[model samples]
Target: MQKKYVTIASFTAALEPGILEETERYLAIIILLAGFKRYRSWRVPIAIYGSALLFGLSHLGNVGWNGETFEATIAQVIGVMGSGFLWAVLYLYSGKLWIPMIFHFLMDYLANLQSGWNSAGWQFNGWATDYISEVLMVLVPLIVTIWMMYGKRREVLEENADRLMNLPVEFNRY
Candidate 1:
């Protein structure tokens, strides 16, 4: 007799809910105005954070898919904002889309497995625990975003220091 258990294929079955979805959505957001190229300098922060917020907002529809009530949906949206922050920061820091895409894939994959795919909503948890999760989801991302942004700002400043200090441009042969 064969023992029934989850397999890796189970995780890979749902493509739309993970990396592919994130890639499509993020590209949609960035491609319109050449956001990757046009937004530079201090504007980069605004663009990243703003797009992240919109990314969270875009998931509002998933609440309905999860069969969550409006209140839970609101909480979920707040929680998703945190995830958006994390993903945005990941992409911004690496300057690579695949980093966040792969992370998003793992996140959704584990999440669906944990929730058994059928009930992948905050409503599945007790009210208190669900609320706590929502709050934590928001806070964790907020903290990471702040920390990452501070370091990123410093790096940007250092890179620009030569120009700001009117130093001569240095070129390297590849």
Candidate 2:
């Protein structure tokens, strides 16, 4: 019973981080779009990559705040950049924030479950397996996101670009 309660509590707690991170991602997208508004053709990609970069860098706080090792934090940052890009692509492709929010929640929930809710900071271990896993983590999402954005999928981005940029609907004709 106690174990069940802990599992439930951890599951709920994971949602907090997901909500916070997604909120930050959304704000980054909006800010980037606003800043690059004049670069009409480039605004969407700029927002995607810029926000992903910011999302990745945001993990650096774990080094100081959680006492994570520099190497571990760096790996985490790169891994999350790919995730951020994927989430951003999911958002744009679906034209719905909830899609990415759910993805983020599931991801955090699984991490919390694996770490047993309140585990200590991550360590690099300096193992070959760690390096391989980290590399795959970064590459898989990047490749998948790139695939998602190709061909007709890009049209989804264009269709939603004006709304994302907060421009008037008529501007979408351009």
Best candidate according to TM-score: 2
**For candidate 1, lDDT tens digit of each residue in 1-174?**
112324555467444556665675456435422444333344445545666677777757766675776666677667767888788667655656777778877776666666555223556355678778888998888887777656545354223322323434233110
Off by over 4 Å in 2: 1-5, 64-67, 117-120, 168-174
Clashing pairs in 2: none
TM-score for each of the candidates: 0.69, 0.85
Give one clash count per candidate, in the order shown: 0, 0
Q: State the TM-score for model 2.
A: 0.85
* lDDT for each candidate structure: 0.59, 0.76
Quick one: best lDDT, which candidate?
2
Per-residue error at 65 for model 1, in Å? 2.0
| Candidate 1 accuracy as lDDT | 0.59
The window of 10 residues in a row where model 2 has the poorest summed lDDT is: 165-174
Per-residue lDDT tens digits for candidate 2, residues 1-174, read 234435776777677767888888888887887898888777778888888889999888788446778888888888888899988888877878878989988877776776654222666788998889888987888788778655677767756767877566542432
